[model samples]
Target: MPSHRAAGLVAGLLWLASLWLPAISLAARHADMDLQAFEQNGWWLLTAGWVGIFSGQPAWLANLLVIGLVPTLLMGKQPPWWVSLACAALSLLSLALPGTTIHFDGGPYRVVAFDIGYWLWLLAAQIPALLMLTELNVRRRAK
Candidate 1:
């Protein structure tokens, strides 16, 4: 449980840290939109998701983080689960997105911003559900 708690905190911290990098650059009116924009920002999402999963931030915090991340997509939103899945997908998609790109180059941007932002958002959001699952697993073991 202590480990779980630490993971949640790390995830939440990642999200908090993520706001300032590529996503923010994309959001600003006069962003550089250079390769560097995507580089660290791309990594930020992955880090946040991993940290969130490990830290066990509260579900409400995840929901809020998702909201903060959605604007980076500049696309229509979906259910939280969709966002969460997208993040996991992005972690894999980095091979495709690669380094040195703007945050709005259609596929690259959506895959990056939406995946990282929405996904991390979704991850934090689902912590409660995971807790329930963990609890059930524990109960089954006891039985």
Candidate 2:
């Protein structure tokens, strides 16, 4: 079994890689009533997404799961099982991002689809917690 630290490091690397890949496809109606679509990657979301909150996009808040996991994963030792479970639960918040409406440049865009980056990010977010849960189960069975 992999150690928590190893799992964390792997997850961290995945999260980093995800930042550069396409995350979401957004569609909005132009002034002429034509629909336009564009893609945004994870880094864009991490940096500029804050402005989205005021524009009725709450999915950005799910980024906090990754933010919160960073310090815990960096710790010297494994956190309690409950901490892992909490992280897992928090990671689920990202699922709500799909179909969400984001107002940008006076136009409302819908999150039409999630791309590779978003899926990778979700996988990365769950890795450490899943590893921790597996470890806990193993230990319990051993005892």
Q: Identify the leading candidate in terms of lDDT.
A: 2
Cα shift from native, residue 60, model 1 (Å): 10
lDDT of 2 at 133: 71
The residue pairs in collision within model 2 are: none
Can you write out model 2's per-residue Cα lDDT over 42-124, one digit (the tens) per residue?
89878877776675555555466656565566664665666566666655665777788877677788999999998887787
Distance from true position, residue 101, model 2, in Å? 0.7
The sequence of per-residue lDDT tens digits that candidate 1 reaches over residues 33-60 is: 5443223353455444343333332223
- Candidate number achieving the greatest TM-score relative to the actual structure: 2
TM-score for candidate 1, residues paired by index: 0.34
Off by over 4 Å in 1: 1-4, 21-115
Q: Model-by-model lDDT, in order? A: 0.41, 0.74
